[model samples]
Target: MMRVKHGSFNHVEVVEEMIFAINVGYKVNDLCTRCSTSQLSQSRRFPFLRPVRFLTDSRDVLWIMDTSEPQIDGPDPSPAVDHGLLAELESLRQSHQSLRSRSAEMEETLLLAQRQREDCVNEIANMSKIIESLCSERDRLASRVGELEELLKEKEDKFLSKFEEELIERESMRVEIEVYKKKFESVEEEMEERGGLLSRSMEAVQTVKDGLIKVIQNVDDDKIPETLGDENGGNGDLRLDSEFMPVFEQIMEVRKLVDLADSKVSEYKEMKGKEKRQLENSVVSLTEENRDISSLLRVALMEKEAVEKSLNKLKGNTEQKRVALLQFAERGLQRVGFGFMMGSGGSIEQPMVESYGASSTGSKSDGSECEEEVVSLASTVEKIMKNLRLEITQLRRCLDESRSDNERLESLTTKQAQQISENSLYIKELEERERLLAQNIEELLVDIKETETEVDRWREACELEVVAGKNEVEERDKVVTILQQELEKTKSALEISNGKLKLKADLAAAAMAAQATAEKSLQLADSRATGLRERIEELTRQLEEADSRERSGRRSIMRICWPWRAFIKVNAGNGAAPRFPNVRRMLPEMQSLLHSRV
Candidate 1:
């Protein structure tokens, strides 16, 4: 019975994957609460125990044997057994009964052990959780302390830097004060020189006043051109001296004013000296304040260094504790694995008689006692097995729930990781965009600087152009003045030329009148020459006719001297050498001669 329960526990432990043992052995009434009949299966070595039930009695043994026969098919052994085999079978029954009794006792003992082990495991689990919580708190506190220490260090560094800067500023101010003191001394020297010059000018004014008064008194009345001086010379001289004497008295008053201006200069110099001393005192006070601030900064830096060292020590300790906890968990898992393997071997079955005990008494009263004992033992074993099985099933259900929860948690983790990745990518993209924006801002600033530079350049160029334009305007004005002068000169020359042309036109009109008179006289001369030439030509013609008549009369005489000559002379050379023959022949000889001559 104990072995049966132990076997059930081994099966449960294998199935549940727990470090603790599982036992399903329990009574029928208790079984209903622990494991359902559906959760159990036959062991590999107990193949005859079908339907999740072990063959505990003779009746179950007989039932298993009969039911498994059809599966054996054709092979059969002899029904009668030999004496030796029978004796062996009887010995086996006795050994089986003894094993059953022992198993019952062992089962009770194991149940008590399991309860105590469960309590111990529970305590360990709780302690582990508390330790984890404590470790987390320690880490959180250490981190906070580190942050505080870092903050203190940063503050200290800043304080020291500020004090250094203040000291540098104080030194710079001291240098500036020294420079100002030198400038003040130079100004004081200049003031002293000016005061001395004023005093000398005042003395010179007094001398000039004295000289003017003497000149006014020594003026000569004789050099003065006075119209009424002749009436009373003494009276005129006395009046002039009276007016000049008052002018000498006014010069004496100016010498007194010079003394007052000298006194005021000395007062101003004293006031400047007092102000210089006050400025020197202020510079000294600022130097003292700078020294005090430097001392405070040094103290803060020392505290920061001490805290940093302590934080480093705490961090090293936490690391060692973490390594130790990891090693302990590893060893625990290895022990659990070894226990599971041993339990698996114990899960295989023995014989049925050994699994379920029988009654030893034959009397009715003894038989009842024996049956009750066996039945009670079997019932207890079954109850314990049922309980173990139930526990295993419940543990398996818990493991399944835990697995489902783990899967859900893994899924949630994957989703969260994905979301985180996306957020990281988004952040990266945003950072890139921010970088681009910063670049754009830088570019914009550069552009603005360039634009400002260009504007400045353009402004300078415009100023130059304006200056050039002004110069050009001045040049144009100069040229316009020169051109106006030339235009006036040209207008004067044009007027003179017009007067000359008018005079020339008047002279030409007079010459044209003279030429007309000469043309009339030349025409009269030409007419007289024509008449004289015609008279000479007429007289020459008359003389030539008279000579011709004389020659003709002589020729008539000569013709009478010859025979044919008288006929030729009568005809007078054939009237005119035969122009028309009939005219010459019909006319008388003298008539024809006279007609031809005419």
Candidate 2:
């Protein structure tokens, strides 16, 4: 038996082994496989999703337990279902509504996230601009800072260098002062010595004056009267009053001497006055030199004091600048200490060390540019130096070349001189030769004249001989006539003798020509033989060289063959050698051919 929990519940006991099937929120079929029971007809009931409420007898409301049938697991439906199925369906609808509400809330969240993303992107853009602006400011500040630093360093270096140079100059000036002081002291000593010399000369003049005064005082009145009478007295009176005359003359001479002494004293006084004037002039000159030196010293002292004051002022200024720079550096570093976003977060951050660093980088870039400019200047300077060096080298080379050319010209001049000398010598020789030739020519002319005279004489002799011959012929003719008169037969014998003489003269001329031809032929034969012998010698030398090469090659080949021959001989003893007798025999034939050619 089954008990129903709600009004919608239906239960039936089955005769067979019964099984209950519960499907919440689903209708049951008439035939349930698990339950052998009568089918509960649920189609007649209207489906409602209201909550099951039960009223107790006391009018108290009690909610009923939901007995909805389980949903079908597969395609099969449950056999029975109560109103619980409607309640389950209502609950599912409520859950779906709640899920929809959650989806809407998620969409709102997504929209808010997107808005925040846009704001963040905007903020990032602003920050980027701020950073860029800060970077620019930093670069500018750094550049300024770097420039200041460089200027400071340069000024300091200049000051130091100037100080060093001034110190060295001062040292040099001090040395010059010391030398001048020594010169001044030596001049002072010389002036003192000169003063002493002047004093001594004055004393010597005073002593000379004293001695002359004493000599004048010794003259007497008697001497003066005698000297006055001696002008009219003779030699005998002078001898009688010799003593008196001599004393008188001495007194007169003394008076003249006193006058001369007075003149000498005046002259000496004038000379001493002149000397005093010269000494005064020298003292004035010395005083001027001393005044000049004192003035120079005063000027030097003033300049030194001024320089010291200026140097102190400069030092103070430098110190002040240094302190100010240090304070600025410290203050700047402090103001730009590390921090997050500033009051103007999206705007720009205050520039600090980073700004200075950027500025320094910019300044460094400027410095690099300056360095490049300097480098270019240096390159130009180097080029100028190179040009100077090249010019120097060229000048030196030119000088050397000029020197060489000069030397060459000098050598050529010397050669020309030698050639001139040679030419002069040749001219002299030629002149001598000409003189000799002239002499020879003169001798030849004389010889020619003599020869001409001889020839004339010969001609005369020949003429005379002709005449004699003619006379002889005439005498012969006469004789013939006489003979003819005596004996006519002798005439034929004389004619025969004359014909023989003519034949002898013709034979002598032919013999002379034949001898000349013979000599010419002998000379031609000798020249031909000499030329042939030279050609033969040349051919022989070539042949010898060729033979030497051939012999050397043959020797090398023979040396190589010797080893092979020895091997062959040894192999032949072992009965392993090849024979070629004809090749060995051809060597002698080849030698014979070469010998025959030679």
Candidate 3:
């Protein structure tokens, strides 16, 4: 028998109650098993749920009821006990069904949440990849921009230095050109003075030749009379020889002076020809230098145009990249915002619906906070985009200014080339004039040689006549004296002309020295120009490589962004809020990624 406490019910009553509770527990267990079985069948029905079937199915409730026979040591069971047991069992079955239905609904919601969580995780991973790629692209672009800026700075510095050198060289060349012009003008003046002297000398030689011819004619006419009277005039011949000896000596001195003048004129002509050839060579060298300078200028212009084209390409690439980044940012923001809202709403509504009015206020507050954060993020993105646009505009203005400067440089170069061409043409004209003068001088030299030969023959004939014409000696003495005086004047004029020729030769030597120095300077300029051209070529190659790299980068970025753009478009078209699972778990990571970059 069982001893019961005073406050407690009798053992019989206790036993009945205990049995009822056990029966109800068994019924609940059965309902739970049924629910679990139904869930498992439903999970099996969907291929997608096969992996999660175990997770979605509710656990089987095992009611460890006392299966052994009850020890009936108290009283016999009553009819009331049976009725009460029946009624309680019915109520328990109804409650068990309700709980089973509720558990099934909860399981379904859990499955949905799990599916969303998986999708959100996948999307978040994709988002992370995209963010990483974008960050890498940003870093690459920033590095490229920095490199390009450095290159531009170096190129600008080099160009400025080259321009300054060119300016200095041009100034030197101009000064040298002016010097040459002054020298040429001086040469022209000297040439004119020499021409005047040559004309005077020719006139004096003509007068001397005429006087000699008249004296020779008088000797010829008196030759027969002198031969017949030679013996009778022997004493007169002796007296005439004494008086004519000085005249004969004077004639020989005049012949020597004429020969000296002829030799001096030949030397002067040779020196003049050499000077003319040197001048022509100098002119040729100068023309060549000018051509080289013009070619260098053209190369510089071509390099400038190439640089401008590269700059334009860089600008276009930068603009495209900016636009792509903006579009990506906007799409990412939209996706993140929509996902956050959907995730928060789903998470909140689940608790609200399940809790049956519990924590409703807290869920509403959480949703508002999420919306506010999203709006702030959007506004910040907008502000960033605005700043970027402003920067782009400023860059464009700078590019425009650079373009204008390039155009101005091109115009200046063109004008300089035109001036150089004109100078070359002027030099050619001067050469033509010099050639004509050289021809005239050669003709004068030939005529002088012929006059010298005729003078020599006349001197021989006059010597023979002097030997035979002793009787006419007194009459010829006056003519001889006059001819001697004229010969002395011719010798004096020849001496003056010889001194001028020597001075002209010295001037030519000085001019040759100046030309050599000019040639050396021009050679140095040519070397420098070659160095600059090589540097320009290297810079152009670098720019081309940079452009190719930029193009490849753009292609890669396009390949990466296109899929995401398409995805965003599809979601938008569907008008369905993008769902993000595990928002509370992923929010921190997404925020860090976005905030750090933005």
For model 1, what is the C-alpha lDDT against the true structure? 0.44
Residue 208, candidate 3: Cα error in Å is 14
**Runs of candidate 3 exceeding 4 Å displacement:** 1-240, 336-475, 478-598
Each candidate's lDDT (Cα)?
0.44, 0.43, 0.48
Query: Please, what are the lDDT tens digits per residue for candidate 3 over residues 96-209?
Result: 565456445545654664565465446445534543553454455345445544644564465457456756765785576566556556655545554433321332233334
Q: Model 1: per-residue lDDT, tens digit, 1-598?
A: 1222334343323222212111222122122211122222211222222221223442221111123523343333223423433565466556555545544544554465456446534643553454355345445534544554464456446545745675676578557656655655665554555443333133334343443333222221123222222322333333435333333334344434433433443354345345445434533543443344334334333433443343344344335434643453354334334354455534422222322343122223332433454354445445545675576576556545544544454454344445434544543454454455445545644654564455345434433333233333334444666787899999999999999999999899899989988998999999999989999999999999999999998988775443343454656867756433344444467555645564
Evaluate model 2: give its lDDT. Answer: 0.43
Which of the numbered candidates is closest to the native, going by highest TM-score?
3
Q: TM-scores across all candidates? A: 0.23, 0.20, 0.28
Answer with 2 or 3, whichever has the higher TM-score. 3
Q: Which model scores highest in lDDT?
A: 3
What tens-digit string does per-residue lDDT give for candidate 2 at 386-445? 554564476456445534543444454344344434434543443454345345534544
Q: What is the lDDT of residue 193 in candidate 1?
A: 50
Error of 3 at 14 (Å): 65
